[model samples]
Target: MEVSKRFEQAINKLYNAFHNDTLHPECCKQCAVGNILDGKDSWKHLSDNHGATTLNYLGQVHQNLGRTFNGYSPIELLHIEATFLKGCGYIIPLHHKNKRPKHVTDKDVLFLGLTAVVSYLCELDKRHDVMDCTTLFNYCNVIKQVSLLS
Candidate 1:
C-alpha cells in the first residue's frame, strides 16, 4: 500500500479505537511501536522480553535510516510521545486499570497520526530498502502544526 494511504488507515483505526473506548493511550503507545516492528498492531504482545525486542527493532530502523538510536530506545520514544500528548493538555492514564479520559482533542489526533506514520515508515523501510524517510518526516512536521477538529 502507498505510505499515505497506510498512514490514513492507521490514523482512522486509532481514532475509532480511542473514540470507541476500545484502546487506552498506554496500549496505543505500545501499538504504535509494535506496528512498526511487527507490521501489525501488537499492543497485546508487550512483555519484558518484548520490550527488549522493541528496542532492538527500533535500533535496526534507525540504522536503516542512516541514523543512530542515540540512547533513545523505543520505550523512550513512547514516553516522549506520551509526554507530548500530556503537554497538549490530554490526561494520560498511566495504569491499565485506570479509566481513559473521556475526551480527546485535535492535538491528540495529530499526535497519534504522527506516531502511526512514523511506525508505518519503520515497517515500510524494512521491506523497501530504497524508501526515503525525508518525505515522511516532512509530512510529520506539517502535521505537528495542523489543527484538526475532534
Candidate 2:
C-alpha cells in the first residue's frame, strides 16, 4: 500500500518522537484509557482530569472519528490498546521473572511508532477531509503488516 504524503509525515513525526524520547511514558500510566478497565475513575472524570496528554489526544481522535472500542471485538480492542501502550513505551514482559530485554531494535520502535501514527491518522482523516479514506486505510493496513512481519 502506498502511503500518502501526510501519512508518511505522520510516521516520521512519531519515529522522531520515539527516537528523541519525547513521548510521555509516565503520563500513559495515568491516562484515562490506561485505567479505563481498572474502575478507578468515571470516564468523564478521567477525561476531564488528564489534560493534553497522549491519551486525551487519542480520545479526541475517537470522538472525531466516531469510533471506539464499544462495538469492536475483544481481540481488536486488545490490538489497539497494545499498540497504544507499546507506542507509549510499555515494554512487554519477557519469559524470565523480573527480567526485561535491554534493547528494542530501532526497526521495532519504528514499526510501533508507525502503527500509532497511522492509527491517529485513520481517525484524523475523518475530520480534516484531507486524505482519501481508501489510501489511508491501505497505508494503515500496510503498517499493520510491517508491524507483524517485524
Candidate 3:
C-alpha cells in the first residue's frame, strides 16, 4: 500500500480498537502509554483519569506512539496536549485564559474538544459521510509535498 493509504488504514484500525467499549478504561490508558512507561502504575493517575482516551487514540497516529506528557500531573499533561491539538486544527486556540470553565483547565477543555473532533472524523470516515473532511487531510498532504519541492 502507498504510504498515505497505509496511514489511513492504521488510523482506521486505531479508531476501531479505541471505540470498542468492551475494552477497559485503564486498558486504554495502557495502550496510550504503551512502551512509553514500564507499566500502567507508572503513568500519572490524573492523566490516566482524564486524557487517556484522547492520548490513546491520537498517540497511535504518530511514531513514539505513547503518551508524551505521562510524567506530569494530569493537568499539566492535559495542557500540553491541548496546545498540540489546537495546533492540529482540532480545537480553537487556547488564547483566552479568563473564560475557561472551573474544574476544567484550558488544557482539559482542549483535550475534550479534541476528543470530540477526532471521534467525529472517525465516525464520518466509517460511514463514508464526508463534507469538509477531505480538505484538512488533503491540505496537510499538500503542505508536506510542497515543502519537499521547495
Question: What lDDT does the true structure give each of the candidates?
Answer: 0.42, 0.42, 0.37
Q: Hey, what RMSD does candidate 3 come out at?
A: 12.4
TM-score between candidate 1 and the true structure: 0.31
User: Which of 2 and 3 is the better model by TM-score?
Assistant: 2
lDDT comparing candidate 3 with the true structure: 0.37
Model 2 scores a C-alpha lDDT of 0.42
Report per-prediction Cα RMSD to one decimal.
11.2, 11.9, 12.4
TM-score of each: 0.31, 0.29, 0.23
Highest-scoring model, TM-score: 1
Clashes of 1: 0
Tell me the lDDT of model 2 at 14: 49
* Angstrom error at residue 59, model 1: 3.2
Question: What's the CA error at residue 139 for candidate 3, in Å?
Answer: 15
lDDT of 1: 0.42
Clashes of 3: 0
- Ranking of models by TM-score: 1, 2, 3
